[model samples]
Target: MTEFGYFLSSEEHGPQALIEQARMAEQAGFTSLWISDHFHPWTAEQGQSPFVWSVIGALSEAVSLPVQTAVTCPTRRIHPVVTAQAAATSSVMLDGRFRLGVGSGEALNESVLGDEWPEAAVRLEMLEEAVQIMRRLFRGEQVSHRGRHFTVQNARLYTLPGEPVPIDVSAFGPQAAEIAGRIGDGFITMAPVPEAIERFRRSGGGTKPVAAGLKVCWALDRDEAVQTAHRLWASEQLPGELSQILPTPRHIEQANELVTPERVAEHITCGSDADAHAAALREYVDAGFDTVYVNQIGPDQQGFFDFYRTKVLPQLNGA
Candidate 1:
């Protein structure tokens, strides 16, 4: 069965709010959780970005649902060795209910440490090496690596869960999907693109679970929902490579000037209709995604959760 999950927006919420959301999501019948890891929000209007590891630590105590980083960039800002250790500890804390989701990363979060942003191709290379190193560390063995992008000497993870934590790799295109197939336990993406899924399966993804996420604004007033989505998530409407290349929240805010409320509504599902929300989620399910995570775009998380629990999820689950 395809599992429905909740996407916790670290960029828009503090740690406590996220913990509460996790609890409520579980109560609302969300079977799993996906949380974004970012050093900074996409735009200043979105506001808060908390330390993801700290939040995950709290989540271990608050929620019973399995959790995964929607996507974390282990290639930059933080070294892969440290990421491996953190993920291992999280797995332990969650009693083996954690998965590590990683990707090539964006300049918005990765460049904050004053490192020059590499090209996409170079970033992929770094990610491959980082994944290799992390996999070794997860095996509870000392690791020594001298690679093109990073190095480690006698690094080991002592606090690991009983089972190895699965690594889910995020990809938007054919090349990254192929890499995910070869190295990842699962695959993650934002869009429900069949071509990407085909590439992943053909390249080596095989029977691994494929996950996707979408954001919606759920409110009684459709117009108000549209405004909320545009105000808080207009950065999402920025086209092409801008989402990947923009280095700061301010840069995203400037680019998002071109994104209007109409455009945001067109791209993101908004408004109060339960059938519409279910239909939006169905697109991902119909695309053969084994997991679909839905995120509510604004502060009215309770309203969204209650709607999904009482009206949306029952229909989807029964279907």
Candidate 2:
């Protein structure tokens, strides 16, 4: 069965609010959770970026649902060895209910550490090496690595879950999809693109779970929802590689000036039409995603949960 999950927006909500949201999501029938790891929000209007590891620690205490980092970049801002330790501890805290989702990363989060952003190919190379190092550490073995991108000496994870933590790789195109297939336990992507899914499968992803996420706004007023989504998530509409390459929230906000409310309405599912929300989710399901996560764009998280419990999730479960 395809599992429905909640996408926790670390960029938009405070840590306590996110913990509450996770509890609410489980009550509302969300089977899992996808949390973003970021140093900053995509736009300043969204206005919050708490340390994701701290929040994950809190989530373990507050919710029973399985959690995964929607995608964390282990190559740049933090070293892969450190990431391995964090992921290992998180698995223990969650009692082996954690998966690590990794990717090449965005400049919005990584550039904050004052490192020059590498090209996509170079980043992918770094990510591959990082994944290898992490996998070794997860095995409870001392690791020594001298690679083209990173170095590690006698690194080991003291704490580990009973089972090895699964790594889900995020990809936007075929090349990354192939890499995910070769190295990842699962695959993650934002869009419901069949070609990408097929590429992953053909490249060796096989029957492993594929996950996708969507953003919506649930409100009584459709126009108000649109405005809220545009105000808080217009940066999402910036085209091409901008989402990955842009270095700061301010830069994202400047580029998002071209994203009008109408555009936001056209893309993001907004308003309280349960059928509309279900249809939006169905796209990812139809594309063969085994896991789908929905992120509410603004602050009506409670209302969204209630709506999903009453009107949306039932239909999706039935479907």
Candidate 3:
């Protein structure tokens, strides 16, 4: 059976609100949880970006569900050494239920430090080094090294759990998926396209778990949901990070003019019905993902989870 879960938006909700939702999600019968880790919201309209590590700490006490970073980048905004410490601490707090999902991040988060965004090749190189450093740290070993991307000076994780946290990679296209197969303990992705899965396995992913996420707007009123999603998150539907540095929400509003609600609506599902929600997520499972995470956009948090619990999940998971 395919595992079902929810992805909380840290950029849209505060840690307290998210903890409440996570508790509710577990009560609603979801088996796992994924949380966004972002330094910025990319647009003011999206509103909030809580420190995810702190939120996860609180969530550890609040829910029974296992949690993972939907994805974080250890290479850019935060060095691998710091990320290693954070992951080790979080793993201990979760009592060995944490999965660290990492990726080569976008400029929206990383470029804020005023460093040049390296090409994909360089980022992959940095990611490999970062993962190596994390493994060494997680072993509670003193690591002192000089690598092209990082230099760790005798760092060790003193607070790790009994087992090392599983590291999942967020892969997009072929090359990255192959790298994930070669290095990652598992794989996380948003794209449900079957070609991506085949690429991952062909490149050496083996029988490890594959997790995917899909964004939707769950509202009893479909029109209101779409409008709200477009108003707040349409910038994400655009191809790149040009709007992230534009300084204000109005700048994002202007850049969004080149794109339309129709474009955003095409990629996202918005409806008051449970069948629509199930159909949307079934695409991911049908494509062979071992686990699927549904992320709801806009507010109506209780209504969204309630609808999925009563209507969507049962149909998909055949409860």
Candidate 4:
């Protein structure tokens, strides 16, 4: 069966709010959780970026649902050794319910520590090495590695869960999906494009679960929801390599100015219609994703959860 999960947006909420939202998600009949990991918000208007590890720690105590980082970048900004340690601790805290979702990363978050953001090809290469290193450490063994992009010496983790944390790789395009299939325990993506999923399977993804996410705005007023989505998430509408290359929220905001509200409405589900929300999520389910996550674009957390619990999820479940 396909599982529906709530996506906790770290860029738009603080640690406490995120934890509270996780609890709300659990109470709302969702089966799992996906939380974004970022050092910065895509745009300033979104106004928040909490350290995801800290939030995960709190979440382990606050909720019972399984949780995964929708995607974390272990290649830069943080080292794989540290990431493995954090994920191990999280898995133990969550009673073996944690999965480490990772990717090649974006310049928007990875460029903050004076590290030059490498091109996409180089980033993917680094991601492969990083995952290799992380898996080695997850085995509770000491690791020493000297690689093209990173070097580690005598690194070992003491705190570990009973099982090695599963790493799901995030990909956007066919080439990246192929890489993800080669390296990941599962797949993480946003769009419901069957071609990408098929390419991944052909490239070795096989029956490993494919996970996806989408954002929607829920409000009594559709127009108001559209304005809110455009105001806070217009950066999402920026096309091409723009999202991967932009280094700062200001640069993102400048680019997002070109994304009009009409365009935002064109892509995002807005307003109180239960069928619209159910239909949006069903696209991912129909496309063969084993797990689908959804994020509420604005502050109507109660309404979004309530709507899904009472109206949307029932429809999706054919009740």
Name the runs in model 4 displaced over 4 angstroms: none
lDDT of 3 by residue, 1-319 (tens): 7889989998788888899999888988889999999877757778889999999999899997899998899998899989988988898888899999999887777777888888787888889899999988888889998999788887887888898878999988677899998889998888888888887887788888899998899887888888977887887676644643454455666788777778877888987877877888888878999889888898788998888888888887652
lDDT of 4 by residue, 1-319 (tens): 7889999999999999999999999999998999999999998889999999999999999999999998999988999999999999999999999999999998999989998898999999999999999999989889999999999999999999999999999999878999989999999999989998998898999999899999999998999999999999998788998999999999998899799999999999999998898889889988999989999998889998998999898887742
Greater TM-score among 3 and 4 belongs to 4
Residue 293, candidate 1: Cα error in Å is 0.4
lDDT at residue 25 of model 1 (Cα atoms): 99
lDDT of each: 0.93, 0.93, 0.85, 0.92
lDDT of 2 at 125: 91
Model 1 C-alpha lDDT per residue in residues 1-319, reported as the tens digit of each score: 7789999999999999999999999999999999999999998888899999999999999999899998999988999999999999999999999999999999999998899999888999999999999999999989999989998999988999998889999999778999998999999999978888888888889998999999999999999999999999998888888989999899999999999998998989999898999899888888999999999999999999999999999989943
RMSD of each: 0.8, 0.8, 2.0, 1.0
- Report the lDDT of model 1 for residue 209: 91
How high is each candidate's TM-score? 0.99, 0.98, 0.95, 0.98
Location of the lowest summed lDDT over 10 successive residues in candidate 3: 240-249
For candidate 2, give the lDDT of residue 184.
91
Q: Model 2 — which ten-residue stretch has the worst lDDT?
A: 310-319
